[model samples]
Target: MAAAEEEVLGLLVGAVDQGTTSTRFLVFNSKTAELVSHHQIEITQEFPREGWVEQNPKEILLSVYECIEKTCEKLELLNIDRANVKAIGVANQRETTVVWDKITGEPLYNAVVWLDLRTQSTVENLNKRIPRNNNFVKSKTGLPVSTYFSAVKVRWLLDNVKKVQKAVEEDRALFGTIDSWLIWNLTGGTKGGVHCTDVTNASRTMLFNIHSLEWDKELCEFFEIPMKILPNVRSSSEIYGLMKVGALEGVPISGCLGDQSAALVGQMCFQDGQAKNTYGTGCFLLCNTGHKCVFSDHGLLTTVAYKLGRDKPVCYALEGSVAIAGALVSWLKNNLGIINRSHEIEELAKEVGTSYGCYFVPAFSGLYAPYWEPSARGIICGLTQFTNKCHIAYAALEAVCFQTREIWDAMNQDCGIPLNHLQVDGRMTDNKILMQLQADILCIPIIKSSMPEATALGAAMAAGAAEGVGIWNLELDSLSAFTMERFEPQINAEESEIRYSTWKKAVMKSMGWVTTESSESGDSSIFGSLHLGFFIVSSMVMLIGARYISGIP
Candidate 1:
């Protein structure tokens, strides 16, 4: 009788990891704590204009539902009952803003991607309106006054989109990050959807007060947005609602996190000072700070890491965001035709001993963290007659490492305690050459997890934890599920500093290349004159700087 009961009630948890370029669903067996089945589908990102990135909100929902269906089919094929899937968790791309109609559950427009720079002028406008010293928004919200956060995206929609403005006036506007949108739709959409967002996702919006963990009315009023449209803030790991539609209709939607926060939890960085860096389409570096909301003197954003329950203490983190990381490699593949496949970058880069005086600064969507330069564009400095595709490939990989090193420097300043090692995950960590470069550049250990797709696993852990089968389970040690490979620094500190200095000079030259006058004049002089001069001078400067710093006469 016990054996029959065991077969019938085999428990499992499902995670929906909705990322910038794709949607994936992963199912984990609670008893064994192992990934049983998974399915993924790429999301199409639409570029309607230069610097404007959008995604069809409805399509995002449809893709997620499809992933769930496919994953469930695989589960059934394995003889795992779909009904046994006890809970569903969600981890999504943060700050990708979505607004919709309250009554009909229809998206007003495409989701404004977090990487979109359409709101730059709007952010500037807001800054001009408010006094510089009195700009409490940053201190209160833990985010800078930039287009990266969600409130400006909301403001842009209200100011530009007629449909969104009309809906706001009619009190029919409904706003959410991707996770909240998915939760509302999965829990029955228009019928009786739960309108809510987790603390982690909410913290990225720039409208949420990090100290109080609530929506700031002053911020809403300042942005000219209606608070009626916002989702209710909730704990990261708790039952938000049950799925009333889709593949797992009856299962409870138990956990939700911003992808980076989910990665933190997935890495079991529950203790303060533990850090994790996720290398996805973009890279996000988050350092756990426990309960204290340590306001970063540096440009790093303070954010809610995760809240397991309503009564559980909130975990805060200082985060450094990289707008371009793995995406640069993708560009080399599709845009430049440097390599046929992303994995091919490793072999091609290995062909060269170093970047060979080349440095690729991928500011395609502008620089994030430390610099926060919205006007900057991508630049490849130090290219020469000898520079080959292999050199460019290596530089592209080095760009990721250099950006991460900058973030680590900021985090060290803010936290006062340096990270012992960087816990790395995501598809990009598979690059052995990149990992070694990361270690040498940062002058620190790079700990790569066996389970590279940690965003989904973190989501799964949150859901399973809510139901008491997570990290707390004695038999299932969270670390046991993951084996780790550590890469230590190989080069001397002087060499690392020299390389970093050259990278910094390249970054400095990349900035202010597009000025307001040039942009407003609609003249190619912005790129033709300023950008060309800067690139040439920067290339020469890097060569000189590298030699000087390395003590080479």
Candidate 2:
């Protein structure tokens, strides 16, 4: 008699995690809510010009396919059947948009990355047309008029790229953040792929209304984006469609969410007042504020935590964003060649106990959150001659910690109840030194996630929940005891305050560095030439468009 075959004990949910630096697919045993197999491949970011970041949309799609295939192979190795994957989920880097020809399935142009500051002029002109306050759209969209949002990035593509402009005018273009692009291609692409986005992803575009949970018409008109090109907005979890091909073929693509929001779900923060922080290429801290949207008086963003199903009530969150986190470590690796690998940062940082009065503020594109200063540039202040690259590395780590501190304080104020401990995840959470600093700087306990792949797991959970399967239940009893590790604050609040104040002095030095003259001289493609006439003409065009949109003579 043949030996009995080993049976896989749990239902599997596959997740596609497309992030800034890379794309990955992970499989989880939803019954236990544990990540079992995974694969990831790095995506190249092309900088054609200074302050410009682009990624080939096709390459991004292909990475998803490759990751899924490799991960499925790993499942087979463990005696698990790939056909057991109940559903597929997606967790993508929010605001990084892709526009493509709906019928041809061809991208109109390289995707304009979220961090690209080519929209500086677009932001400046839009700000001129709107109210003086930065939070002009906060009441409706819960976002600001900034380069980080998808609308401005899409606007830049519409105005600058001739092919994209023509496509838009002809009604042949379909605009989507990374999630929509993937789902479309995954389902059928040219052969009738579903073109829709989840509520969490839709909320980042500055086009979606937080209250009504639909795309706003006035915001689209203000951004000059036609409503037709936008995707159909849906809740975070539902049966959007089925996978067209691959090992998990015919499996429902049931869930989708932005990265940080996915982390919020994975952290099991379904209750109000629970908060989590993610340390990735950028840093994000989100505090669930329940059903009602709480607009931040401070510079934090109000965003959707998650909408589990069509029938589920919407959950709102107060989010604080940091523009650069792990990317700063990448700078030391790539730009300075101080270290050969990104993870080496921890060892070098451990050489010094602290930054030693030196501070490194990487406002490279510009600062996000509490200080919405777009013109700010990076600076390494208080640098004595004795300051080595080690000190710089140490300070770089401290910079991320300090930025998290700023966001944490802002969240506490908005929620009116302090978060006792921060639930933290992401690649950066691996560095114990950084975790300790985060705890010390924030003067709170830091609880690191047991699942390092919280973003992917969250998407998986969403997919599983749609099928009415086992997910990380909202109840604490359903959680795995190994799900977290707590790091207590080593330093007192006074010392933390003293260190943070000095960091503030360095931050002030970095602001207002990008004036018109500097911008014109540095990034000349936007202005064509550094002339007063060119700027005047641009302003005139903006005024004309603004007046036309408002129906004002």
What's every prediction's RMSD, in angstroms? 4.9, 9.5
Cα lDDT, model 2, residue 103: 70
Cα RMSD of predicted structure 1? 4.9
Error of 1 at 457 (Å): 1.3
What are the lDDT scores of the predictions, listed in order? 0.84, 0.84
Give the Cα error of residue 290 in candidate 2, in Å: 0.5
* Candidate 2: residue 263 lDDT (0-100): 91
lDDT of 1 by residue, 300-397 (tens): 98999999878888989999999999888887777665578899999988876788889988988779998888878888888665666677788999
Off by over 4 Å in 1: 1-10, 467-481, 516-525, 528-553
Q: lDDT at 482 for candidate 2?
A: 49
Candidate 2 structure quality by residue, lDDT tens digits, 1-553: 1123323346678999999999999998765776788999999998765566889999999999999999989988987778778888899999998999987899999988888877887788888898756445778998888889999988888887899999888888999999999999999998989999999999999999999999999899989899999999999998899999787789999999999999998888889999989999999999999999999888899999999989999999999999899999987777656688998889878977777787888887789998887777777777554556676788999999999998888888888888898999999999999999999999989998677888998898888878454443435354445457889999889999999999988899888766644442245433332332234223434533433212233
